[model samples]
Target: MDWKTITQIDRRYLYIILFIFVSIPLLSPLNLPILVGEHAQAMYDTTETLSAGDIVVCSFDFGPATIPENRPQAKGFLFQARELGLRVVATAFWASGGPLGEDILRDVYGSDFPAIPEYGTDVVYLGYIPGNEVGMQTFGDDTWTAKGTDHYGTPMADIPLMQDTRAAEDLSLWCEITSGTPGEQQVIQFVQGRHGGPAALPLVVGSTAVSVPGMMPFYAAGQIVGILNGLSGAGEYESLLAGAYGYPTELLAPLDAQSVAHVIVILFIIAGNISYVLTRSSGGKEK
Candidate 1:
């Protein structure tokens, strides 16, 4: 093999190699070493501190396109909340987020949840609230006014979980599993701290990796108490929770695919750079 060719490998070959590397990990998880970050730890701590009977509101600001990145986060939070005996209120800003939130909860709770609901009393899903920021603000002020009924078409007053839990003031924490606009930013703007501004209602975020840089400012300023970033962050969080709860971590194994893809890209970059330097030293001739 010509060493200089490393810098000039066919793009198709690169694509094929990358496909195999990514697919292999998916088919057979490598279970790569995942170092839990401070943000994911903070997220865990936020949920850990909440007392039983305290209500935790989760805003699903994501959609089907972002399932892989956001679903694990929902699992971690919902499972912890269930074990802690805490109540949860699920709502969504994006149009598609409502059903996804319900599905995520059902996966954690039981297939019977919200549908045949053996676990229905403690959890209420408000479903898709319209008008994005306006809807979030209204719900924060008075939960029933924003949407009289839930995703299942049950009136808010009829749902056991919603009977007394109106407004953010009654809740203990705000957690958002978010993707793009009208997400955490909108919550920060309209819905945060409706309980009382003495201290802004505590916020925890679970966001796509691409959204991490944007969320850092709020996290730094303490507007967000914790964050779960992208798929890797989800896996890290699963590991932490598994340590505490002894539950199986489904994400960490599958996460090897994403991790392998990243590592493969980095390796290619390094190899190409080395080849470029060698080519220059050899007067631009292939060896």
Candidate 2:
């Protein structure tokens, strides 16, 4: 048996296999178990502390580029807030994030049973605040002073929810569904940092996978109470919501594909290593 052949499986074949693996779950979710992460748990727990009618700042700091990860993260939180009767202040910092956040908000808040949530009272949209980190600082200091209008071009004064929000301090929680710029770091420095340490307003981050490592120190320092780390974070938070509050899993289809793809990749790696070892034992030279 030419052991070398095992090491030379066609790249196209691998691609086909992976594509099949991913497609199967995407088409029909396998209900794979997604173990909850500590960061996700922290996010859930921090949110649980707030009471009904408490205000939550749901900042969609990601754009279309990060929708795959941030969409479910935002949706899960929005669902939770709606269920618990928490008022949400939906806004975005990234220019593109504005419309994207509006869509997510619509999906979660749209209801037929009791009619859709009242826009100005149940949730308020601030659209996209420009200036990145500087914009965050300005908005954090005084919400309406920087942007006198909400997303709909309606004057802030017309929105009753705006009355409760003069600054970040007036809100109960800061949830940054972020990808970059005015993301976790900016929130830590400008939003959370503005308040007193130890007694500062609690924050949660729904970050892209790559950004999670850099944000961990802040999480450890207690500056951030919870983190939704990438698509997996969304899955974990969704799972918790499904289990604890009996909410249906909205991202299960994508998450099942993600889990299957990961498993397939790992199995291939193990097979490759075993083949390499056998080849070495058969007098094959290592490259």
TM-score of each: 0.91, 0.90
Per-model C-alpha RMSD = 2.5, 2.6
Best of the candidates, TM-score = 1
Error of 1 at 172 (Å): 0.9
Report lDDT (Cα) of residue 75, candidate 2.
91
| Pairs clashing within candidate 1 | none
For 98-158, candidate 1 gives per-residue lDDT tens digits of 7898888888878887665534477888889998888889988888899999788888777
Error of 1 at 92 (Å): 1.2
> How much lDDT does candidate 1 score?
0.84
Candidate 1 TM-score, C-alpha based? 0.91
Looking at model 1, which ten-residue stretch has the lowest summed lDDT? 191-200
